[model samples]
Target: GLRVLDNLPAPSLPCEQDRLRDFMGRRERGELLIQKINKLQEKLLKKMQLSVSKDGFVHFGDTVMLLNPDSKSSVKNCPGACVRLTLAINLDEISIYSFKSLEAPCGVSAVESVDPVARNTFCILSVDGAPASEPIRFGQKFSLGTTGGASDRMLYLASDHKSFIRFAKKSHLQQVFLTDELSYLTCWQAAFLDPQLRLEHEGFPVP
Candidate 1:
C-alpha cells in the first residue's frame, strides 16, 4: 500500500500556495526598494545642509523644502478618517507628502485660514484635469493663460516666477474659483488645503 513516495519524487506544492509565496516575495522586494529610495532622499537632504525652523519647516536652497518632519497638524473634524499629511517639495514638484492624503486633504481641509480680512487672492493651479486643493507655494512657477487659451504648469521654483498674470480675465472672476467646477477649488477649500500656509515659503517674500 505504501509506495514510499520514491516513484512520485516529491509532492509538489499546490498552485494557490505557490501564488501566495510569489505575492509575498514581490511585496518584500517592493518594500525594500521603497526603503532604499527613502534613504537616498535622506542623504540628499543632508548634503544640502538644510535646517528646520521652530514651527517645524525644513527649507532653503529655494528649490526644495520639507514641512513637519514626520507629518503633523491633524485636520479637524475629519471624523473616522483624518490622517496627518506631509508637505514635501522636490525641485519641480510641490505636493502633499502622504501617499493617502491626496483625496483626504482636499475639499475644505484647511478651514482655519478662513478670514474676512487679511485674505489675499490666490490663483489655483492644476495639471491635465487635477484641481488645485494645494498651495500655490508662493514661488511655484505660473504663466498667464494665453489669449489662445493655454494653461500654466507648476515647476515649483522661485526663479521660475511669472512676470505677469493673464490680463484677458475679467475683474472678479480672476481671483475666485467657484465650488462647482473641478477647474479649481474654492478659496475656503484652498485655505483648508493649506491651513498652515506651508507655502508661505518664509524667508522668501510673498510674491
Candidate 2:
C-alpha cells in the first residue's frame, strides 16, 4: 500500500507530496520578502529631503531664480534703508535672493512707536528673501566703516569680521559690530543681510 523511498513516504499524487508543499512554501515566502523590500524602498523615498547645489546656486526644482551677488548700490535717500539677501539650502537645491517690501518705496525705517533710543535703530526688511516680511535690526554694537579707517561706506558687524555686510560705495564699506553673540532672531537677520556674508562666516550654506 505505502512505498518508502529515501527513508520517506512517497505520495501518489504530486499535490500530496512533501517536496511540493515545501516548494509552494518557499514561493510564498519569496513573495512576502519582495513585498517587504518594495515597502522599504517607498519609505526611504518619502524620507528623502531637498538640498541646494554645491556651486552656491539654487535649482528651484522646476525653474531657477538667478541672483546677482556682485551688484552693489547706494541706499539713496533712506540712510536707514539697507538691502538684505538670503540663501537657503535643501536636500535637493539651493536658493538665493534679496528681500522686498510690501509698501511702495520699500526701505528701512525707524520704529517711532518703539523707544526713543530705539528710534536711531532701524530694521532691514524685504519681501523677496528668505523669511520674507521680517525686520532685521542692528546688533548690539554696529560699526560703520573699518576699525582703522580703511573704508567708510561699508558696514561690518561683530558677528562677522572677515567681510562687510553693507556697502555704500565702491571704495567705502560700512561696518557693524554686535555687542554679544548672535541670537536666533539676529541670526535670521544676518541671513537676510547677505547670503555671501552668511556663507563666509555662518558655515551653513545660507537659509
Candidate 3:
C-alpha cells in the first residue's frame, strides 16, 4: 500500500541513534583504558627486573632458589630482601631464588628446602577464576591453587585474615596480591585503596 506514507512518525530513530552513539563512546573509552593498562603492565615488569620469555616462562640468569619459610626470617629485617623465579626453556623445570639480600655482595644461605615435587601439585589461576591459559606478567592478578584436589578445597593466600593464607571454598577464592618492593614484586597488598576505583583494599585487586 503506497498510500502517502511519508508522514508516519519514525519515533524510534532518535532513541536508536542515541543508543548506538553511547555504545561507540563506551567502546572508545574501554579501548583507551586497555592501552593504559598495557603500559602499566610494561612499567611494572621493568620495575620488577624480570625477563619473561615469549612462551610465558620466566628467565633467571642463574638457578632459582626455593627458600624455606624458617630461613626467610634471617633476612626479614635485613634491607632489600628479594626473591626471584626462573623457568626452564622446555617448561619442565622451574627454579626459585629466595631471601637474597640487596646489600650483601654474596648469596645468603637458606635452610630446610621444601620438597620440589610440591611444584607439580599447584597451578596458577587468572583473575577471572579460570586456569591461567596465558603466561603471567606484571599488572595482572593471579591465585595459586592445587591442580587436582577437590575444586572447592583449593588454598589461596589471604593477606588480611589472621592467617596469612586461607583456603578457597566452592564459590570463593582468597587471593594473594603483588606489590612493588624495592624493584621486586613482593606478595603484599596496599595499606589504602584508591577512592576512585571503589574497590575495598582487601581481597579485590590481586596486584
Best model per lDDT: 3
Q: Per-residue alpha-carbon lDDT of model 2 for 141-180, expressed as tens digits?
A: 1121111111112222232233465532332443223222
**lDDT, candidate 3, at 79:** 50
On the 0 to 100 scale, the lDDT of residue 5 in model 2 is 72
Q: Arrange candidates by TM-score, descending.
A: 3, 1, 2
Residue pairs with backbone atoms closer than 3 Å in model 3 (clashes): 64-96, 65-96, 65-97
Cα lDDT computed for each candidate against the true fold: 0.29, 0.29, 0.33
TM-score of each: 0.21, 0.18, 0.26
User: Which portions of model 2 show Cα errors greater than 4 Å?
Assistant: 1-19, 27-33, 45-195, 199-207
Query: Candidate 3: what lDDT?
Result: 0.33
Q: What is the lDDT of residue 145 in candidate 3?
A: 34
Cα displacement (angstroms), candidate 3, residue 94, comes to: 28
Q: Who wins the TM-score comparison?
A: 3
TM-score of 2: 0.18
| Greater-lDDT candidate between 1 and 3 | 3
The CA lDDT at 5 in model 1 is: 53
